[model samples]
Target: MIRKLFLIASLLAPLPAGAEPLANKLFAAEKSPSTQESMPIGTYAKGCAAGNVELPETGPTWQAMRLSRNRNFGQPTLVQFLEDLSVTATKIGWKGLYIGDMGQPRGGPMNSGHASHQIGLDADIWMLKPASLTLSRKEREKISSVAVRSADQRSVTKYYSPQHAALLKAAASDPRVDRIFVAAAVKIAMCKTAKASDTKWLQKIRPIYGHDTHFHVRLKCPAGASLCQTQKPSVSDLSKGGNGCDETLAYWVSDAYLNPPKPKPSKKPAKPRPPVKSARTYVLADLPSQCAAVLSSR
Candidate 1:
């Protein structure tokens, strides 16, 4: 009994020294859903989930990787969307999606590798779909996702196939999906090949950086989420213009992008880099006021 008591106390202890408050230590300490009321607190980059559900590690058409990160938790809507998308992938001649991070158990900033997803409305779905869906947890951790970016890093490589466009089309078909971030090359490829009937779905596929291995999906804020904040109109609007493959894409392929300017050599010694604050570091006051109540609830 004393040993068990010691373990509990240790788990509740404050974070080690010099850690950034942006990746709030409290988020790592939370292991259970805070409430049954499904609501998001703020924007995807600055938010928390009041109630979250865990996506099972493996499903009929998909498998969640990096289980050790414990980021398989998300709002119920997000979880359902992923499961449904997995079925869509299977229908389009691919095995199924290999899922990446969703959000932390409490749905806040992470220690690393993402700027959004703090609100549980965002998910990263790997382009690599395992031929089989029965991979063990060990395999899930060891299997590396292949990068579909071309050697030049401006376009999709040979590994990217027509099936990828089909997959993205399926994901964007859902009205709930607000935006899907992919590389410039992928967007261009879709613009060139998408049929007339399918061009509208292309509007939701925005070109972004470093999504060679996975595409991020963000959902529209669910109905009746009063405290939930919506992103600016530009982000949510997909009908502003044609598929973004005109002069805008040229920027990604320009020398400025292909060969970025290096920093001028500093005369003085460089100052020490400051600590990075992740979503996990956000304190209750740093987030929506209601998040405090969410964190403290069951």
Candidate 2:
């Protein structure tokens, strides 16, 4: 029957593909190169260029994993940042540098899987654990460093080793780092340290909460690349207890100005009833006795 044939065809139909891959569609929106001379380099410009530098492939523990070579700053830059950080730590006599997550293209949007990890400019470095420190069962339980199954998830903790602190300092000191996330207390500590070190880049470092378990370093996007989605610092909501540290920070809840005012509770008027029509009247003598009796009873 036609119904059977239709059912078979429906079952055989191919499934629709998901959204277009980012690697293929990126840079399609960029305008053609201009003939004008390049702009002069500034402090932020230096930071952007340093952030875009290509990194090596080998890591201390993990191998470099790239999504696409054609994609700008995909895996190479991330690996380079790691290698540079490791090298910096070694120069300072610190050891045990391990990268947590990098270069995850299939992860979900921001706030999900390592979204920062998607663009290849972001990385999560694990907290350093020294071999000399003896940890009781309870103390070990307090330290957070779990094995992540996917390349997108990151662990959160409240503790940081001195070595970890050094690595964070090095990254924040680098001109390539646009922003770094650590603990609130650690940020305050870094501010004091930065003031003592006479390094202006450390003065530029901003601290946030809940990143004590790992370090999240984000780099500025490179020239002519649309894959990077670096956000400029905005005004913070000081009213909500968030330190509005950045300039031009706007109150996120400013939409209260546009919201409709609450309606006042008022008493409702009673509904009117329909007017009833009087029954047709007839002279008592002209009406039939039964009908007249019924009407009289009504």
Best by TM-score: 1
Q: CA lDDT, every prediction?
A: 0.80, 0.41
What is the Å distance of residue 86 in model 1 from its true position? 0.6
lDDT per residue (tens digit) for residues 1-298 in model 2 = 6765664444334435543222212112211211222111112211111122233333443222222321123334455667777767666555445444543222111222332343346666655543323334344334445321112222223444455556676787787676776544455444444444254454334554345556667766546444334566642433443442332121111233225478787699668888642111112222222211211111
Name the lDDT value of residue 270 in candidate 1.
88
What is the C-alpha lDDT profile of model 1 across 115-231, one tens digit per residue? 688888899999885777888888888988878888687777878988888999888879989889988788888888988665777778888888888999999899998877887
TM-score per candidate: 0.85, 0.46
Worst 10 residues of 1 by lDDT: 232-241
Model 1 misplacement above 4 A: 1-23, 235-240, 262-281
